[model samples]
Target: MKLDKVNWENYYDKIKGRSPRPLLRAALELEKETSRPNGRFAIDLGCGDGTDTLFLLENGWQVLAIDAEPVALERLLAQVPTDLTKNLQTEVAQFEQLTLPPAQLIHASLSLPFCHPDSFPSLWQKIEASLVENGRFAGNLFGVNDSWAVNAHMNFHTKQSVEALFANFAIDYFDEEDKPGRSTAGSKHWHIFTIIARKMSDSSN
Candidate 1:
């Protein structure tokens, strides 16, 4: 579904100063143990306001920050520290239209659930295919019980389906939050799956 540009700006404005998502922080921590930092590439998918993108850049990773809303990218670029500008890139595109490069990590945070259900499967495949062998995906998926599950424009998953999405990868961190919570929008029941999984090499599986 097409979101109004102004509403998108307000939504992002509310979340502008938030800290990076935990899944990404954990993914980076894992990176610290398993690989060298030099020239590591990462994609910050649906990176609203660049919270996670800035974190990735500050930590020395080359970041490709993407958001469907141009205002989001504008705010992100405006806030980035000048010293870290060399390693950052930005794109304004929706999920279904994205073309990603092979990267060591992809952080989607709360983004993927917005992809239209019809296009989500193919998008998922692209994610898997774009990762280098053993590369990681750190992201969130909304569950079937989410308050917004009734919204036809958004994608929601069952627990079984969520697991199925990772059939070829090894799950590193998984959390299912199915409880009432207050969001920037208001109070509602949230069913969210936070995941960090590693792509498996064909021979390793």
Candidate 2:
């Protein structure tokens, strides 16, 4: 699936009122356990309609929500609470062109797989570089078994490759799911890896 701006805008319209992703919720809960400082920063890449962004803001995290579609950003701004609006910053840009700032948490949710295959490696590098030590990354990555894996425009990874990508991170949550499911767009047979990993603070390299 080539996810152009039009498709993302339509997707935002369809899933506007959806709840935040469970993976994100789990990551937040983990952060709470550490009694971490409030107002930590987060980057929500491809933050369509800002479901996750809104949740982060409500919980006191400053968020930089980036999406390629203007409509997505508009819808997100409309849905966010006025009080939390000050904590939110939005950028209209694609993942391939992303330049992320250092953050305590990086939440991509269901977005990263939409990146073009050729651009995914560079984008992944940026994601890794943008994270602070001990910072967490919470998101889904499409598996090779996904129905959309055949699409050259979409990035899909095998289990081995996914593991290799996070070799420098200490994985806190990793689940591989290959089952029939429907997307917000009404697509079926979803294969995904739900991941929440913290960068290894002790890594020397």
Candidate 3:
């Protein structure tokens, strides 16, 4: 789908007041086991409506919230508590145009699938390069069998391909679901891979 065709403002309003994705909450829970500082930085790729972004800030994380839609950034910035403003940064940029900074955590939620198939490899490579040692990546990828897989603009993966994407990371959390579901876009069959993986050292930390 053309980025301009998306009704981002309306989409954000539709999901307003909802909690952050469980995948993000799980990633944060895993962080508690480590000795990382609460003030460590995280990146929220394709952060919509600021739910995950606000959660990160509330927990003392410094966050760089990025989304392609200007309205997305505007809504996110507007909802940020005044005191937490210093903890947050907003960027308006697309997946293909992004150059991520190294971070302790990167959360994308239900966003990466929108990346064009041809650009996904390079974007994924950039994601890997942007993580600090032992950092975590939490997000969902649409599966090949998803109803939306027929859309030529979106990227969908089979299990083997998804596993290959995380070959260098330790799979901390992984769930595959194929079922009927509702999205902001409308009702659809959802075949998705929910993942949270930690970057591993050579010794496999």
The CA lDDT of each predicted structure is 0.86, 0.86, 0.88
Q: Pick the candidate with the highest lDDT.
A: 3
Residues 117-177, model 2: lDDT tens digits: 9999999988898888888999999998898776788899999999999999999999999
TM agreement with the true structure for every prediction: 0.93, 0.92, 0.93
What digit string (tens of lDDT, one per residue) describes model 3 on residues 63-139?
99999888888888888899999999899988987899878999999999988889999899888888877889999
Clashes of each: 0, 0, 0
lDDT of 1 at 102: 81
Worst 10 residues of 2 by lDDT: 1-10
Give the residue spans of candidate 1 off by over 4 A: 1-6, 36-38, 202-205
What does candidate 1's lDDT look like per residue over 33-137, in tens digits? 776443589999998878889999989899999999988888889889999999999999889988888888999988898898999998898888888888999
Would you give me the overall lDDT of model 3?
0.88
